[model samples]
Target: MRVGNWIKLSHLSAGFIAVLVGYTSSVAIIFQAAHAAGATDAELNSWMWALGIGMGISCIGLSLRYRSPVLTAWSTPGAALLATSLSGLTMEQATGVFLFSSLLITLSGVTGWFQNLMQHMPRHIAGAMLAGILLRFSMDLFLAMQTQWLLAGLMFLTFLLARIWLPRYTVPLALVAGIACAASLGLIQADGLAWFPATPRFMKPEFSWSALVGVGVPLFIVTMTSQNVPGLAVLRANGYQIPATPLISWTGALGVVLAPFGGFAFNLAAITAAICMSPDADPDPRQRYKASIWAGVFYLLTGIFGATVVGLFAAFPVELIAAIAGIALLGTLGNSLALALSDEHGREAALVTFVCTASGMSLLGIGSAFWGLVFGMSVHLMLRRSIR
Candidate 1:
């Protein structure tokens, strides 16, 4: 595609906002992971750098290559896994683990193992997993009201009114309105807001076979099966058909560069990326790649004001975050749930997948995401084979 036929700056701005909203709203939990790992401010910025650089390259490169919306973000579930699992490991040790994990995921993508697994996923089950992923965020909308009534209520109302009247601008406009209300209401925190830009610190790579297996292996599995697989599915379902090899390689290279800077690992986003890539984002699909690009630009901004930006994100009330996110995801969640249960032949297995994932059950340290897919696919295949 010629540069003239491609999106203009205006469309790029819109696309960036779509990604910024999608990525930031969901990644608040990343702070928890950083804190749990005892990361210093520099390391935190490194985390941002790793994540931002990775995401920025992927957004610009992937969208340019696929000519579709290919917004990638850090794996939220993997972040959650780290928040729980990073306690005992040193930052350097964790870095070692991060590097090892990323290499494995890169290999999976290159060897087509990851792609092969995704090809086996039934449409219905994929849909169910998508729905299951969004289910928590959707529920967060209402839950946020209990803590910050006025702030969340206003945002919720803004979302509802815009959704009813002008669906396209609901999220962007509501986000602006929420910031205004927050600033006026004294909800914005200026304390400890730093001067000067972030300085990223680098750590040399170290290796430990024990840490590799204990932490690295789990990280790779969680990032791949739970994050990237479904992330690609989002792109495919939306009709973008970029080959998978380059996407994986790029993500891995980004990981390698950022690992020393407290970037645990980066992977394809499933739920959050869906938010930026959805039809609800804008009526024009060709234009949607702009969202990922815009998201990348914002991510770059995030890298600059790494410290203060976290505070800015903190300003929005939980209710507003949840409401905006949930409202944004309405179309995606609905679509996934519909597909998950729609196939009679795959119904039983898909239902198992949805129920198990939704149940939030974990066994032997494996997430429900992996097991849910496993359970669903097992039943799906069994049912298929029996029919033959």
Candidate 2:
């Protein structure tokens, strides 16, 4: 427990950015999903509580066991799907679907379905999808400049200068610059800020074929295809050899344990995981897991503070959030795109995947990530057949 040995400023900075980016990007969608399922203010607090606790425990526990950064998150795409599909379902029915989805995820891990699925996925295609998923955030870094030119422009310059001068501290420096700029502009909102603890509110489960088919099944599919698949790809792309089954199992079990309190679908994290796994988190790859452990500590604090934590993050201007996230992910995005198109044969297919995923199209309730994989694989198979 020597502070000097385990603690690094870079690791702490990475962990903080990971949580900050995660909340700023899609927490609104999560709030929408909870409300769609008839969640009250208290229930919404419980949902945040469950999700934060689950992520914190799994990130710390799994990373320590495997000695690698194994970050986990509630399925963002799954939450988006629920926001649309859970419109008419009662809270009890929604809880049932949550439980059912967790069961499927648990089985996927326990039975090695996740590993089997990953085994068949091409590395190039995975990289393509990862790049595609991240491209928008990269664009956002510049897009933020359109509205808040002063704030974002300063951040972009700060990021470039930090990369040149400080390297490992690039993101942290840019974040500080963005926040300082935001505050100077009077963009930070502090209304209704108060301390409060997260309290769990349970809903009794109710099952029906309608809820199962309409909600549970689609949630399972989206969580796996959109979140877990890309998540595993992030791990593989980073040269981690941790077993996928155990990681999946642990996340699924945690999801199930917290479902009654509104933990919907838990799975491996991709973008945030990239932040922790990147070299900016630590100089030595072996030490990067400590970044995830720190992220866990932040998540635990968020859970303990409940709605106050949400409000705290929400207080930051959107442009600042976008600027910081774009800066944080630049390294991982560059590496993914480079590796994806490196092979001559896979180049075209990977491009197709990248374009499709970056397009952010949704059809039939499935997100762009899944469709990107489909398009990429199809093009790859066709190219191989033509060559033969």
Candidate number of the best TM-score: 1
> Which window of ten consecutive residues has the lowest lDDT sum in model 2?
360-369
Residue pairs that clash (backbone atoms under 3 angstroms), model 2 = none
lDDT digits (tens) for residues 95-201 of candidate 2: 99899999989998899776676576677887777677667667788899999999999988988998788865676677778888888889999887789898888
Each model's TM-score? 0.72, 0.70
Name the lDDT value of residue 181 in candidate 1. Answer: 76
- Using lDDT as the measure, which candidate wins? 2
Tens-place lDDT digits, model 1, residues 49-97: 6676667777778777776778777766566556555665678877887
- Give the CA lDDT, 0 to 100, for residue 60 in model 2: 94
How many backbone clashes does every candidate have?
4, 0
Q: Cα miss at 283, model 2 (Å)?
A: 13
Lowest-scoring 10 consecutive residues by lDDT in candidate 1?
Answer: 4-13
lDDT of each: 0.70, 0.81
